[model samples]
Target: MYLGVLALTAFVLTVFLLVYLGLFLGRLPFLQLDRTGVVLLGAIALVATEVVPLSGIGEVVHLPTLALLFAFMVISAQLRLGGFYDWVVVWLDRRALAPPVLLGAVIAVAAALSAVFSNDIVCLAMAPVLAQLCRARGYAPLPHLLALACAANLGSALTLIGNPQNMLIGEVLRLDFGDYLRVAALPVLLGLLSTWVIIAGLSRGHWLEASASLLPSALGRAGEVGVPLDRWQTFKGLTVAALLCAAFLWAHWPRDLLALAGAGLLLTSRRLHSRQMLGLVDWQLLVLFVGLFIVNHAMQQTGLPAQAVAVLADEGLDLQEPAPLFAASVLLSNLVSNVPAVMLLLPVAQAPVDGPLLALSSTLAGNLLLISSIANLIVVQAAARQGVVIDWRAHARVGLPVTLVSLVIAAAALLPWRA
Candidate 1:
């Protein structure tokens, strides 16, 4: 037993190190690894090393969580096919709103869309539109783009479908969608308000100068002009998505099957290349969830999770309670990114309402670092394409304070309820 424990501990430590190295370094012998790739590789390493018995893997693989994530991905994909996000961005950009007013509108729209679709996808779809609009209106895209990223992350906490991690946490905790929203709604509102204030402050005097007339040189060719609206297709996608959301809240439908069917129905398109839809699917994220599921499961088999909980308890920090767990979650989430950290901690904790706290803490915590969330990175990368760069220093200027403020609000709102 002692030998087995020793081997498992060593294996888990090695797996984590490899994952971090892959994330930080980007290349392994045969793999150009992203976060997902690194996690999956770590799972493979654990299995190859015999650190976790094959049977033990079952304990960590949460089928319900995966089902929820897969369903939301399909729904998000359907919306993408309908060009729903692009339509919204185009509409918003066409308005003659002032810069600060426009920034506020941007925050509201980004938050709303992210509450339904994947936040990362929302950022990717809107970033270019925002950048082009900013250049056209003679506004700097940097601050606005950063606002979009921060707002999207904040908004994702509003609904289970907003982000994959929330989906996983909600399903695993069997949280009622309506109830969870009620619990998280206040903090989310506060977070959004905080996002607007922090970003507006960062932009400072520049917000006044943000709307100069577009330079002649700033004029550029527009993006892949989308087709005249296929209203039927768009309606069909929206109907299916709305029904699914209602079903998830009210009915007992197998969400995965329903979502997959919905996605399949939308594929009846001769105009849009199947490749276009296929390319948009975030397969790496799915793979990352699966891999982390396996690795986190293997690591749990070592008894470390329970042991850690006991140690925390001895130190007057019980994760089964809300306050300490919330605090710990924020720290770990920023340390290793939320998804993986959630995977690490979820096993040992026990609280029915922990889901909301976990979801809120992890998602909001992404505001702490430039590299903290894929959604943040997506905004940064998209802005770079338009010659608007947001480096670590630029991001931290807003992210650090925003994270601190939001976490405090969320904790105050949740900790009392737990008591």
Candidate 2:
């Protein structure tokens, strides 16, 4: 028994190190493997080594989280194919609003959309539209683009369906959807407002000046040509989204079932082909979650994580406590991405506040640095394609303050509830 325990411990630690190394580096050095590839490889290695038996894979993978994520991706794809997001951008552009007011509007729209759809998808769809609009109007695009990413991250914390990590927390903890929203709504709103102030304040005089030359190829002629709205398809997608939200907030239906039904409804459309909708789904992300679920569950079986939690408790830093859990959530989130961070912390979650604390802290921490969230990188890469660069320093100027202020607000709000 002792030898078996020792071997399992060694194996778990080795795999954990290798997997997180790829996570922190964003890719394997001198290899083409990205973070998703790295985690998938780790899971495969564990199975191949029989560290986790092939038969046990089913038990390790969490189907509800995957189902919810897949359903939402399908819904987001429908909205994208229907040009709902593009219509939103075009509508905003046509409105005669000043820079600051426009910034606020962008933040609000991005946050609200992200609160329902995938935040990465929200940034992916909106960034190019926003960039082109800013350039056409002779204004800087960086601040607006950054605000979109930050607000998406903040807004995603507002509800269980907001992001992948939040969904996992809600599912694992069996949290009341309405209860989580009630606790999280104020913090998310305050965070969005803070995001606008920081970005607008930092970009005050620069909003009118063109900051970078637009690359014609990067800003494709088709992109600037404007996407025509298919109002009927858009309305169909919106109605399904509304119904799903209503189910989550009021009805006692299984969230995965409701979400999957909504996705199915969108897929049966005449104009939008299944191929086009499926093409927009992030299969890679779903695979990443599956891989991490197996890998983390295997690690948990070794009992090291539980032991570590007990040790920390002895040291007066109980993870079951709200404050320490919040701190750990922020630290781990910035180190690894929020999904993996939340997966690691989920086993220790017990308090009623743990669900919201993990959800809010992991999400808010995503705004702390450029590399902290995929949403930030998506916006930056999209901007870079248009010859507008947002480096670490530029992101930190806004991101650091927004993260600090938002976290402080979250802590003040949640900690008191614990008391």
Candidate 3:
């Protein structure tokens, strides 16, 4: 019986490591799969191996995380389909702002919207439009797109509902909505400023060029139809978003329920079909979350995590400590992505400080490496579709400095709070 437990532990550990390896490399060696597909496969392997029984799947996955993620998707989809995002990009571009000034504006707007809405959705909606706007003006699109990716990440740290991992952290830790803002606002603002500065400084001379890689002249950059702005639909989306924010800040009820209710209300719109709203929800990301949750829960049941924590503590590396927790959050986030990292370390999160520490570190860490954040991937992929290439080197040139500066600011901001 004891040997059976050991065998289970070893098998689960191997699966966990392999899953994270696939995530870090963005694919498994012989398999053509994305991050989502890799995790999904790992989850199936766990269930099939009976390391986690099929009947126990429901108990492992966090329903609230799924609820909040899906609901936010619907909200963001409503706003995007209303052409709110397109209008904002066109308006920003029409200002005739100088290149440096325009970069700052893009960063600020992306960060602010992401703080209220969802970061991935903000990037998903804004990246292509920003690319088109830049390309139309004979400007390079990489800097602006990088700003969108980095700032959206930094901004998402400000509010619990801003991103998926933040939502999970908030729900699991039960951090107060208002209090998190109060603590996170200053750091996030500073980080956004830092992001703008670094990206602007790095891309200074290149901004005006048609780009190093010229597009095929025959390609239709001129008359690509934009999502038309519908004022009434925009108003409906904005109204729901505003009320949801108010409820999140003031109401003490379960946030997932409130968000899901808001999504349900939006689906009842006379014009926007329920299918359309539901269609925009990132079923892939939701599936990824469900897979990771199941796999991690099965790993936790083996008691390996606690044992590892004990071993690390004996070496004076206590994960429950704030400083160590912060470092671990960043490292693990970079290694396996933020959501999985948080789920793995959540057991050792001992205080309210751990919550903020975990949330900020993990979110900020996304900016350091291109593959670390889904928002970064979305922005990069969106740009590619627009014939604007933003490779890892281009991103890291600004991303590394921006991440370092932002993390320092966050650590300093939380210093007094820790005391």
Global lDDT of each model? Answer: 0.77, 0.88, 0.87
TM-score list, all predictions: 0.89, 0.95, 0.94
RMSD (Cα, Å) of model 2: 2.7
Q: Which candidate leads the pack in lDDT?
A: 2
Q: Which residue window of length 10 is worst by lDDT in model 3?
A: 212-221
Instruction: Give the Å shift of residue 116 in candidate 2.
Output: 0.4
RMSD of each: 3.1, 2.7, 3.0
Please name the candidate that would achieve the greatest TM-score relative to the true structure: 2
lDDT of 3 by residue, 19-134 (tens): 88988888999889998999999999999987788998888888988898888899899998998988788778767667688789898899889987889888988899888777
Candidate 2 Cα lDDT to native: 0.88
- Once superposed on the true structure, which residue ranges of model 1 sit more than 4 Å away at CA? 1-5, 20-32, 49-60, 208-211, 214-230, 268-273
lDDT of 2 at 169: 93
Point out where model 2 deviates above 4 Å.
Answer: 210-223
Ranking by TM-score: 2, 3, 1
